[model samples]
Target: MRARLKRLLPRTLFGRSVLIIVTPLIVLQAVALQIFYGTHWEVVSRRLAAAVAGDIAMIVEMLARHPGEETLAWVTREAFARLELVIRLEPGAVLPEEPDPRTGPAEAELAAALAERVRLPFRIAWPRTERAVEIAVQLPDGLLHVEAPAKRLFTGTVTVFVIWLIGSALILFAVAVLFMNNQVKPIRRLAAAAEAFGKGQDVAPIKPEGAEEVRLAAASFNRMRERIARFLAQRTEMLAGVSHDLRTPITRMRLGLAMLTPRLGEEDRAEAAALERDLAEMEAMIEAYLAFARGEGAEQAQPADLAELIEEVARKARRNGAVVTVEAEPSLVVPLRVDAMRRCLTNLVDNARRHAAHVWLGAARSVRPSGGAAVQITVDDDGPGIPPEQREHAFRPFVRLGATAGAGGTGLGLSIARDIVRAHGGEIALEESPRGGLRARISLPA
Candidate 1:
């Protein structure tokens, strides 16, 4: 039940906040309406009905005491002119056999009011006409018929009350929405900044604002970002220095080996050549380590054609005598660090070229489950693919598959590619391709 409720809830903080504020407001308004209609409105209707019934009793009493044609005419004329009531005298008239079932409060109130004030055999008719009520009180010689306007007994206080209640609720809701939006804006900015940082994009420092908790969160995020940046900077500098120091020794050894090669005997020259190969492999390893540790070098994100980038990588691989097939949409642009993304694709393509005779590179636009746009690039090869269990191990730096360990690589290609892809808020997955080899799938948000 808890999980189901969570699924039904609004996803964003802003939407949930508004729901929290408005839910109670709606419940309160409903309660207020119930009270007004059930109690206040009924009370007001009863009071008005009683007042009108009293007026009718007084008119009937005056007519009974006078009992003459001139007096009756004067009373009817005076009632019409002053009280806004129509009174008439009907001679030799009978009452109805049955009366309406007194259901509503207004009808009940009028019936009780008439019984208390008048002592005659009277029948009341509440018809659907201009006049609200018709009271026919029987007299000895005739009958007294009185018609009163609907407004007299039923004042529109309930309608006015409802309007005032709804209007005030609407005003309060508008104010709540405005306040909630202002409160949520700072939190949204904090989230955006954090996401960008996680994706290795350079974002400006967030200025703490809004509520105290939001301000505290922003401050904490800034501190964490600074610490991570400092750590990366220190690590990159250390690796760069190591690479620089090692390169000097390797270069000196290479030159010395070349100088001794021309003067040495066949056995000595063979030994020197093997030593040169070792030195060259060491140089390649150092270069790979430096490249992996550089962290793409503070390159800002810019819109670039992803399809073109893929095609270029494939073209380069093709030039190196690899059979490369490219299938990519034209002009699929996305915000990314061009150099970093290009390097990542080149690494994947290069790795494929090393083990496979036929390489397939594919790029296309895709949609994520969250209704956002994404770009997917796939590199597949028809070589002897790594075992499913070992595919994950291949992504670890310096950890190569046993089958491909002797294939002349420093084993940092997949690791470096994964690092760059992940830095751009993307993922790299290895799976069995349709081509009977491994597939490197890269998915990046646009």
Candidate 2:
């Protein structure tokens, strides 16, 4: 029940805020209308009905006391001029056996007032005229036919009250929506800036605005963004210095070893060759280390064709003596740091090529778990797949699984691929491939 209610709720702060403002307003107005109709409106209607009925009763009594042609003519003129009533005497007419039932509050109130004051058998017809009610009262010598204006028993206040309620509610709702949109704009801007920054896109600092709490949050976000930028800059510079310092000595050592190889004894020549191989391996490891430590380093995300990138990675793997095939949807475009994404795909492809005889790459449009549009990239190999339990462990830096232990690698391939993918606000996971090996799947938001 709680979950169902949550699903029905507004998904954004602006919508929820309007609901909060409008709900109580509606309820309060409804209560006010109830009280008005139950007391003040009803009382005014009853009083109006009583006054009209009392005037008609007085005319009936006067006619009964003085029954003559001259008196009748005088009473008709007085009733028309003073009471706004049209009256006539039918010499021997009879009342209807059954009168029509009262259907409205005004009709019901008028009928009750006549019953209490007139004290005579009569029938009322609302259809006698468009703007009047016909009342016929039975008398000893004749029937008294009276046509009373409908306004006598009904008040204009009810219509005016209803119009006021509706007009005021609409005006209030419109004002609340406009005010809330202004209040929510700054928060929306903050959220967008944070998402862009996470995807490695450059974002300018946003100005603080709106209420005090929103302004404070925006200010804090700007400060945090600056701190992170400063830290990344410092780390990138240190990594560059380390790469240069380490490579210069390794190059010199390789040159010196080449010079000494020819002068060594036959057995010593084999030892020198072994030492050279170790040196080359150390250099490769250092390169991998620096590349991993440097991260994506100041690269900005821009629109790129993911399909083209996959084909490029496949082509490079083919040149490196690995059999590779690519099947990608054309123009599968998304924002990416081209070089960083290229390196990331290269690592996955290279790692696959070392152990498998065949590799396949694919890219296509997809959807993220949260229902957003996304692009999916897959790298598949026919080599022995990692155990399900060990796949996650393989993504830990320098932790090669037992299945991949015999595979010659720096053991940073999966780790580096994951880091790069995540920096682009994407996810990478390992799963069993239909090709009977491992599948490296990547999902990036479109």
My TM-score estimates for the predictions, one after another, are: 0.83, 0.84
TM-score of 2: 0.84
Give candidate 2 misplaced runs (Cα > 4 Å). 52-80, 85-150, 265-271
Residue 329 deviation, candidate 2, in Å? 1.9
After best superposition, candidate 2 residue 318: deviation in angstroms?
1.7
lDDT of each: 0.87, 0.90
Residue range 226-310, candidate 1, lDDT tens digits: 9988998899879878877898988998999999899999999999999999998998888888888887858988899988888
Q: Which ten residues in a row have the lowest lDDT in candidate 2?
A: 95-104
Query: What is the alpha-carbon lDDT of model 2 when measured against the actual structure?
Result: 0.90
Best by lDDT: 2
